[model samples]
Target: MSEANKDLMEKYMKEVALRRKYHEQLVELKGNIRVLCRVKPVLKEDQQEEGQAVVVTTDPNNESALSVINKGKARAFELDKVFHPQATQEEVFQEIGPLVTSCIDGYHVCIFAYGQTGSGKTYTMEGSVENPGINQRALKHLFNEIEERKDMWSYTVNVSSVEIYNELLRDLLSKDGEKLDIKINPDGTGQLHVPGLRVTEVKGFQHIKKVLAKARRNRITFGTKMNQHSSRSHALLCITVHGTDLANGSKTTGKLNLVDLAGSERVWKSGAEGERLKEAQNINRSLLALGDVIQALRGNQTHIPFRNSRLTYLLQDSLGKGNKTAMVVQVSALESNVGETLCSLKFAQKVCRVELGPAHVTISFRMTRDAMPYKTSQR
Candidate 1:
């Protein structure tokens, strides 16, 4: 082999070593779905006149347990991880950083935020511009990793953002508010495709930051009794990474889905009317469907109901039998919202019990022959 070819082969070998290292680390971290609970601090304005009494507290004995006090009774719930109101955005991301990195090693990953209105779901997923939250941190880490591996592998990253409002899918990146159609690919990959969605090829963190800003502006939000600017739809941000081994003829495709579900709320509590009422009902309906899917998965049912909701349908691949998933359940600590907090925690508990089969890497290799240089077979 020529000098250039020899150098390329050495680089490829190094890439293979790095990939194997990541793969072994991922295997150690793989398991059933994980659930994390985060408690939001009670704002001064929301505090009772006499400090009626704080209703939520973390267990001193167990860091992963939360104590919820109501009417002189205390109940404890356990989770994979629990973040107190004082936890910083950086602290929260530290726990999930490994799962995010696994995507680069060819594993599908889905991270979702679930909670009641006025809870900390949005805050945890998308914090202030100065202290960006999980989505931003994950993207930055992913880009940095890509840069480090640029010498051995070439990567193409594309991003697509969409929102589900009133059971309809709208492209958050598009200028017009047009409903998009979703199709299930019949190629046996069990992937859902949004035909008209505008996916942008992102070069780096700055490019993705601009796309995120545009999507946030286009997302549907409205005022509610609990939150002034409550999200009226479930917004999903998808990052598709396609990597090619430069020296060896191999390819890998991985996807990371960051979802911010609209807060689950009661219609009467929110005092919804007209459009708001419709939005609330739809949101609740989709959440209910999600609950059903989780229940079925937990029971190890032969047929999982991914088709019950648009959100579930679109996420069939990621939530199915062989992917890594994590959920951050946000809760409010105010006494007034105790009931809703309990409900959110219960749902999270169920989510924690659902078992997704062992995670697998989605990578394929190509064989080169003297006669057929371009032929490839997926393994």
Candidate 2:
């Protein structure tokens, strides 16, 4: 490499390192849990007139303030950040990019999308091919960080995907589609594990692409009056990063959990019945359980109800103390969705108050089973 190019690269790496350090300190000072709000534009299928009123409004001067109309009353909510409907996928990811890359530094991170049916939760978490969302962007960011630090660090990334449908856990990457169970670590680590779940060692972006495509194909989705392609299951993509410092012979492990939760639905509005009704019921129950857990955490309760549902059970580690977490609440701006949007915003307001404490970096020589959390699968 030319001397000039080498100098430029060194300068860039220094900048990245400095920025990362600053973000780490900032996040620590603010606590671990962050809540961001995103407002999605009305689509053609919404069937609203061209000049129809928008019930949700954002303050141009204050990016963190969101207001919505409910029963002719204006209610305002404050979050960590707010994204307008015109915001691009790249813009959304930029804010959380540090959280995604922090896994390399051995900080556990969890990012999930939550909202009512057809509120663009899935789109925000897993966007279209041309404008890939957080899941794709996070993987790429991690890979790039690995490459940039290859001189001093050796990293291994393991990927796993699962779906909780009807209160049952199914391995998304397993060919058998078998039901999986979460087992507490026998070593007294107090960590949860999923036996026989497929874990793939990812080396490059191509491997990530194939795994994500397969996961999306395996996820369950169905049509409803509110949404034609409503996701009926909560999907989690777990990326575990194992890093070894060559200089000191020390090791560290971190996990980045990318979750796309099934949107909460209103039964009367969605017109759900039969099997669809069952799925909706399960989804609502799980989401309610998650909210309960959050409430318990915020209040510093004696017991956290993680075992109440499959979704919360699987995410116990990430949502617990000493880990960084972020939630993106997507809401519709249409007047018709005002009621549901209010519910979503109120839930997000509650989420903003939950503090999970400062995050810590894991440094150890022994490889923890919970780091991988699943069985290695043959590709």
Candidate 3:
């Protein structure tokens, strides 16, 4: 072999050794499906008279428990973690950062934000551009780690953004609202494919930021009585990282799914009519299907109904047999919204009970020069 080829071989060997060490360490760590509750403070407009005070309170004795009082009656729910209304963006991400990093360790991971209309789900997942949110922060950290490990391994990153609107899958990165189909193979690998969806190869954080901006412009959003800017569809941002060992050509592919589900709302409560009513029904139906899937997993049923809805069908892989998952439930603290708040908390409570077996790393071997990974480029 030539001198350059010899050096590349040495680097690949080092990466292989590092990956094996990481796999051993990851196997020893416990991976639990977790649900975190976040309560948004009452807005100025939501402030009521003395008799109608905020109904939600964090338990002083138990940090993970919260009580919601309605009509002089109080109900309590417990979760893996609870963030009071006073919690900052940084504090929230601190709890979630580790889960995002697990993708770099070769585990498929999903993070979901679930709540009712007017709740803070959108704020928690995609904060203002000035402050940045979990998605942006996670991308920044992933690229940083990739740079730090460039000596031993090289990584290719690709991103795709899509939304489920009125029970149809639409690619948010496409020029128009292009419909996409979900394909499930019976190969026993639990693989899902969206054939025509646009996947952009992103070089770094800056590239991702631009792609996100373009996707946001194409996302479906509208005003509702509950909130001025309500997301009208369920949006999913998928990041695929393919890592290769320079010397041995050992490869690992990890997918990180960041989902922002459209707010779950009652049609009558949201005053839906005509097109709005149709959209609301579709959203609620898909969400109900998701809830059913979660319940089935928790019950360890013989058959999972992942095929019930397009959203669930698309997510069958990350949520099914061997992946790490986390959910952040956002709730409103206003007394008037107590009913919806309770429903959201109950859904989250059920989600916490569902468990998948320990996450497994995806590893493969290939010839060094013929690896053929996608080149990271700008749109």
Candidate 4:
């Protein structure tokens, strides 16, 4: 590159950095914890159901509010954002693109989809190849963001996938489907770490796609009365970004967690039995524990109950202080699902009120890497 070209690139980078700083200010003004509601489209099967009626409606005047007609009375709920039935996957990703990119700047960010069975949580988190969802879009965005900053910083992206089933943590990227355990870092950082979990270092979006595909194959799903191929476990995709400033050699680590929670459905409705019954019980219990933790956080309690469940405990770092978190509560518009939809919206409303404080960039002088027992390819 010519000296003149180098100077021009440097000037452009400075401008980009300044613009990002202003954008961060705007995001901070919005809040650290965001709660979004997405009303899943009424599918053909939902239409075929005898009792299926349109009970949920979006407020045209208020994009942030939704109304549900339950017990012949309409109740309105407000959230940080609301996606109507016609909203496309691209539209949903656009709303969260900024949050995804924030991880490149060393912020711990987590976005999870929560809802009842077959309410489209998985679809929203992992859309079809024709229209990829947040997980794919977020990683691709990070790749572009990193490439733009390559002259100023060098980064390594590590990916890990885990499933929480029956209150047990399992490595979703492992061939043997190994059960895992969470422990505090021995170095006294008070950070949680999962032992025996698989972490893959991806050079770019293609590598991430392969990693996600393998994890998806290993995730547990089952046929239930509520829906076919229902997720039996909470699937969590954790992406950690490690960057070293080229100018100063200072290092920073940021993490982005994309979680697809297991369906929060009633046992009687799902007709769960035997092993399925056990799974449903655990899933509901863990979700309840999560709600309790959120309630404690909203009340500013001294104890947050992070250890009440494995799902909550594993997400301690991301859910606790100085982290950006968002929840996309997926709901169905079918009247048959009105009760579950109401429950999901109410939960989202509660989550919206919990202030997680401002997220800080994590920088450290220590240079360390996790021991890799699995395959990790880099460019």
Candidate 5:
């Protein structure tokens, strides 16, 4: 290393030590979090008005015998598109590259989507079968950035995916016919109990895509009245980034989580049967638990209650604990779903109130000053 390089290394080492000590002091400081609310374009047929905005002043119990039929179909572009038009589903895909890059640049990140059934959470998270989505786009970008910036930095990426099924954990990457159990340790690291759920380490985009395809096929999906192709289980796609700042020997570890939550549907509207009903119960219950956890965090309650739900327990390490978390709330613009949309909005509002600790990124510095050599001679 050149003299200038050595000096820089020494300076960085000192800075890292200082930051490590400060991390303890600032662990309680709130993190930077923001909510992005994207309004799904309303379909043409669902845009009809209630003719008279019908004044059904009937009973405190219910509206009987009279139904004000919407005479027209809703349009897809009825939403105020000024600032909220969804990224063409394509534009949205393009946005993930920079988001993941943010993590590699030394920020712990979590990006997840929330929306009602039939809304477009899957489309945003996994994308259309024919087109790529954010997950693919981000991985592709990570590799491309690595290859293109060969002289700048070298990266190693590892990815794993899992699903929360009825409060139980399942590995999404498991073999088609095999069942995998998920194990969570007290130290906070999780593992798949079954050997079939292989967490693969990937180098390039193609390999990552192949793994994603197989996982998607194995993901738990079920049909509901609200959405013909709704996801019955929650899916988590994670990418672990490992890199070395060749110039400064600053080793950084970053991770990005892309979560697709199960669709939210009412028991009456979904017309769920035995199995579907069970799935709905699990999903709604877990989501409620998550809400409570969020509320507790916002209130700074001594007892977080994360252990109350498996889903919340698994995420305890990520939220409020120095991870950069971003949530996009998706909602249909159609008035028919105003109730669901309202619920989603309220959830988003609650999420906005929650504060997070400053994002803490791990930086391991390997310096020549700290290096020691071992020499051996055999006689």
Candidate 6:
């Protein structure tokens, strides 16, 4: 082998040794795997009698239509009223930020969005371009916190996004073919070769916002009864955080995974057929696989079955097996979706029970030829 080949081989070997060490250390991490739920918005029916003066008799700050009519109780199993359902995306972020911040300050954290078909998972995670979503809100907040602590620390952050379809990686940014296989490098850097998909490094919020806006335009969408603009694909948006306390010089690496899972659907209920049918089946299949992994994780099963689906496999490292995870189960308040509502709540409940250990955030310090893994904080 040539000298260059020998160097690459040495680097690859070092990468493997580092991962093996990280894996072993992962067993000691104890995580805060929590799931939060958001309520969908609503509008009072246009004055039923078109020309009559409408006298509103209810409190503006009153409970949801269901809570009002159901005497403050709905069939949705994990329905929580401590937090409002129609809460804005920012409101939900406020409710969840502290919990996640706690993990980042020194713990492992994974935050993701989950819900049934058209229940507003997309709106909650990656909202309309006109109105920013959770990802945008979180990025802004992270930077704000960093700015406030400027005298005490310096931080670096990098982001990567990918879509897993049919157990394969489909680079949403790629202009070439439909899909490509992702090889997770031992150095903790993911490799992508799809003709059009690209991972851009972001230094500030503006750059990220621009990319997010473009990504929103490129996100997969399809029509359905629950939502005419429902998302047909899952998106994993990860922020790798690196911090060095200027005061103590204690370096910390942390990662916050914000996932917007494709809403789950049924053929009969969604009236999905043709390409829609295939998409629904693929979605349901992957979600079921996710459920299985969660179930096994809760029971402390030795074999996690992540290999069953691309979604689970890709999330393997973040779902309590290694990373500290959080899930926000979003549901619509309309009576039309009581069944889906309950299902989403239950999924969140199951997710809360799984354990996670200290998560060392993976970030690249510098690169001459390729990846160089470095560690950062617990929270």
Using lDDT as the measure, the top candidate is: 4
* Model 3 steric clash pairs: 12-246, 12-247
Q: Determine which window of 10 residues in candidate 2 has minimal summed lDDT.
A: 221-230
Which 10 residues in a row give candidate 1 its minimum summed lDDT?
359-368
TM-score of each: 0.84, 0.83, 0.81, 0.85, 0.68, 0.66
Candidate 1 residue pairs in backbone clash: none
List candidate 4 stretches off by more than 4 Å.
Answer: 1-17, 220-230, 268-274, 298-301, 354-379
Cα miss at 64, model 2 (Å)?
1.4
Clashes of 2: 0
Tell me which residue pairs clash in candidate 2.
none
True-structure RMSD for candidate 6 = 16.1
Candidate 2 structure lDDT: 0.82
> What's the C-alpha lDDT at position 296 in model 1?
70
Model 1 / residue 87 / CA error / Å:
1.0
On TM-score, who's better, 3 or 4? 4
Candidate 2, residues 1-379, lDDT tens digits: the string is 7999879877876775697688789777765777889999778888556766788999999999999887788998998899998999999998788887777888888898998868888888889889899998999999999998898789999999997778888888876567899999898998899989999999988889999988776654222322434377788999999999765688989999998888775674558678778777888889889888776766667898998899889989877767888889999998878888888888888767555343232333225534665745622
TM-score of 5: 0.68
Candidate 6 lDDT score at position 206? 90
Whole-structure CA lDDT of model 1: 0.80
Candidate ranking (lDDT, best to worst): 4, 2, 1, 3, 5, 6
Backbone Cα, N, C clashes tallied per candidate:
0, 0, 2, 0, 13, 23
Superposition TM-score, candidate 2 onto the true structure: 0.83
lDDT of each: 0.80, 0.82, 0.79, 0.83, 0.62, 0.60
How far in Å is the alpha carbon of 82 misplaced in model 2? 1.2
Badly placed stretches (over 4 Å) of model 5 are: 1-31, 44-83, 90-98, 129-131, 184-196, 220-230, 247-250, 268-273, 297-302, 354-379
Better of 1 and 3 by lDDT: 1
